[model samples]
Target: MSATRICALSELEQDTALRVEVEGVPMAVVLDGNGEVHAIGDTCTHGEVSLAEGFVDGDTLECWAHGSAFSLTTGHPLNLPAYEPVPVYVVTIEGDDVLVDPAVTRPTN
Candidate 1:
C-alpha cells in the first residue's frame, strides 16, 4: 500500500507520539530519539488504552495503563503486563511531510 501523509515532520517532537486516524485505523505516529518517525497501532495489546498517551524512550514505547513496553521497531513486547505484540506500521519522511503505511509492518521508528 502507498504511504499517506499525516502531518509535517516539524510538527512532531522527538521522543513523542501522536495519535492519528488513517483510513479509519487508529494509529500512533512516534518520533524517536534520533528524530526518525515510526508508526504503530494506537491501542495497547493488553487493553483498550491508546499508545499515544504512553511514553517513548529510544526505540521503546511504554504503555501508561499497565507499564508494558513494546519495541517500536519490531512490535515485540519488552516488559511485563503485556504478552501480545502490538501492530506496527511503516513510516517514511519525505521532505517536510511524514508519511505512513498502516498496512506495512515495521520495527524501527
Candidate 2:
C-alpha cells in the first residue's frame, strides 16, 4: 500500500471535502460532521462528474451532478442513478498532515 500526503488537517473545514489526486487517481478527502476524516473516489458513480463538487451531510456524500448520495464509510451508493459503489480510500491523520493509502481503495461492485 502506497501512502501519500495530500493536505494538512487544518486545511480542511468541518463538514466539507477537498478534491485531490494521488498518483493520478482522483480522491475526495472529507471532514465529516463528527470531525472524522474520510477519503472516497472523487468521481460520481451515476455519471462522469466529480464528487468533490457535491455536498456532505453527516456521513453521506452526495453527488452534485445527479444528487446521488453515498456512504463515506463503506462507499455504498445510497440513491438512484448510482447503484454501483464507488472506491473509498483509507485515510490517516498524522499530526497535521492527511495521509492516504493510494492502493487500498474499495473498488466499485
Candidate 3:
C-alpha cells in the first residue's frame, strides 16, 4: 500500500516521536532507542494530550497528561487512566523519508 510521507528520517532523533497528520488523523511516528520506527495514535485516550509530547523509553511512550504508558509496537495501553488502546499506523522508510500509512494497522500482539 502507498504510504504518506510524514517526515524525513534525518529530522527524527532516536528515542523521540514526531507528530503528523494523515487525512486528518493525528499520528505519532516514533524512533526507538534501537533505531526502529514506530507509529501510533498521537492523542492520549485518557486526556486531551499529545502522546508525541510525552517521554519515550525503549518501545513505550508514556503519556504526559495521565502517566499512562502505551506500547509503540502494539498501541495498547500498558497502564491505567487509559483503558482504551490507541490506533497504530504502518511505518515505512523510503530512503531518507519517513512514510506512514494511516489506513493500514498491524494486529496488536
lDDT winner among the candidates? 3
Error of 2 at 102 (Å): 1.2
Against the hidden reference, what TM-scores do the models get?
A: 0.91, 0.93, 0.94
Indicate which candidate wins on TM-score.
Answer: 3
Instruction: For residues 6-37, write the lDDT of model 2, one tens digit per residue.
Output: 99999998888799999989988899978899
TM-score of 3: 0.94
Q: Model 3 over residues 35-56: C-alpha lDDT tens digits?
A: 8899999999999699999999
| Weakest 10 consecutive residues of candidate 3 by summed lDDT | 1-10
Each candidate structure's count of clashing pairs? 3, 0, 0
Residue pairs clashing, model 3: none
| Number of the candidate with higher lDDT, 1 or 2 | 2
Global local distance difference test of model 3: 0.89
lDDT for 32 in candidate 3 is: 91
Candidate order by lDDT, decreasing, is 3, 2, 1
Clashing pairs in 2: none
